[model samples]
Target: MINAKNLTKRFGKVDALKGLNLHVKKGSIQGLIGPNGAGKSTTIKILSTLVIANSGDVTINDIPLKRGVSVRSMIGVVPETPRLHENKSARSELRFHAKLYGMSQKEAKSRISDLLYAVQLEDAADRPIRGYSTGMKKRVALALALLHEPEILLLDEPMSGLDPVIRKQFKEIILDLKEMGKTILVSDHDLYTVEELCDSVTIIQDGKTVVEDTIESLRHETGSIAIELRVSDDSTMDGLESKLTSLDCVTDVSQKRGWVIVKVRDSKTDIPVVIHTASNHTDILEAKQTKITLEDIFLKFAGGHHG
Candidate 1:
């Protein structure tokens, strides 16, 4: 439902985005992730029509984004740090946005009540936003964004700086939105959250698109699997690394905290062989495939830059 091609943006001499292309299917949550200055926010700004790109073509639901072409009505944007009127109550804030969208008094009130309940801010809806916690503020921003019920949602670092409990709540809200068939493009620094929430991820680095695919597909395409084996004792790990390394499918092996980690060519066949080899030397405490995490994939693409 969202498409951008050859998007480029610059500030003075620094290029924020360079020929970045992105696509999000309808009813799917797509993640845009990168280190600092990788242009994730810039991409979202362009998509939200908050900032015009230096060069590119963009469309939401086939309606082109150009001068005088109104795409804002079709998009809901919740910035990384949403700027809400601190003194205004959550209900009032949403009401203002609803009126801005030209909703009638009755319709706006009904929608505002539903959104407050949806964000779980019903009791505190009458309280001024300045007294709310960071997570609560995010919920208010989200409710404001959905006031008009836009078809597309752009959330930039919506879960950043949130505690585990609040982050979980926020994730559930996003999932609920997805269930309602909203096309979502979320930019986040948290790889774990992105992996859990997004259907597909687009990794950009140095102002360029590095990779875009489902997490499982990226792991498969990377073709590196780690098999972790815990021996009963450290002495049992001795010579085990060499033995595993000698195998045809084993690429590399290392010991950590009394556990032998073997990088293999194939997990399905190599793991069984690794287990059999270790069984000859030591009693196995634990043997399992070490699943590759999103952090591993991000490090590979971003070169360990965690900014």
Candidate 2:
């Protein structure tokens, strides 16, 4: 339950967010994705009350963002690079945060214990954060965020720079949060993670939202289902391409590696026709249907084909 309208933020001459708008539904994971300079982090900062927007209206859980203290109480934030006291043990770090949140001794003890277990750091709870790995630090950051039991989470690049194992763990943790009814807004460049975790996504470019919809709806709207085929004979590639290009159902055709990638309006009805056309010119080596991916959606709407 987070909303921002016409959000604009500037630093000197550069505008980080130019009329950016976002809406994160209650109890759902919403993804904020864009290119390197598209202002994904800036949007997260504004929502977390770490940075004030130049001009915008924001609300968290129906409470106006103008009440920074109230908004802060309802949301937990984990930045791209988590900051922690290197000398302190993970338990001490979380315990200190519990104090800052005004948690009572008994309450703090139990909550900290639960969070450490939740983040899978109970075994290393006594280890100094200085010796922890990047993934371990991320887990500590997540534990710190949950220390106060906030209703919403704002995660900026939580899955960045993690090995596959740790990434899988984080995915499970985030999903568990959703099961606990926490609304989450994740800003990340990892399209695979976004596709796996988010209920809906908002794609922004040039500091503005270009598209916002569920993954399925976006895929259908773009009509990007593909029929990928490879010709057995390299010499016959050109002929096969020309034949597939003439089919009315084929929206576009391109080549990659040794495969002919054809974007079609409807895969179920177009795949057989595309295969038949290709077979007429050359022996079909391989063929398969593929669904549109988040990266495909990003290039289409965010216009970063070359970037």
> What is the lDDT, from 0 to 100, of the residue 164 in candidate 2?
88
Give all candidates' CA lDDT scores: 0.87, 0.87
Candidate 2 — what's its lDDT?
0.87
The worst-scoring run of ten residues by lDDT in candidate 2 lies at 298-307
Index of the highest-TM-score prediction: 2
**Where does model 2 exceed 4 Å of error?**
67-69, 305-307
**Candidate 2 global TM-score:** 0.94
Residue 87 error, candidate 1, Å: 2.2
Model 1 scores worst on lDDT over the 10 consecutive residues at 298-307
Per-candidate clashes come to 0, 0
Model 1 agreement with the true structure over 191-298: per-residue lDDT tens digits: 888989998889998778899888888876654688888887777687788888898878778888878888776777888888898888778888878777788778
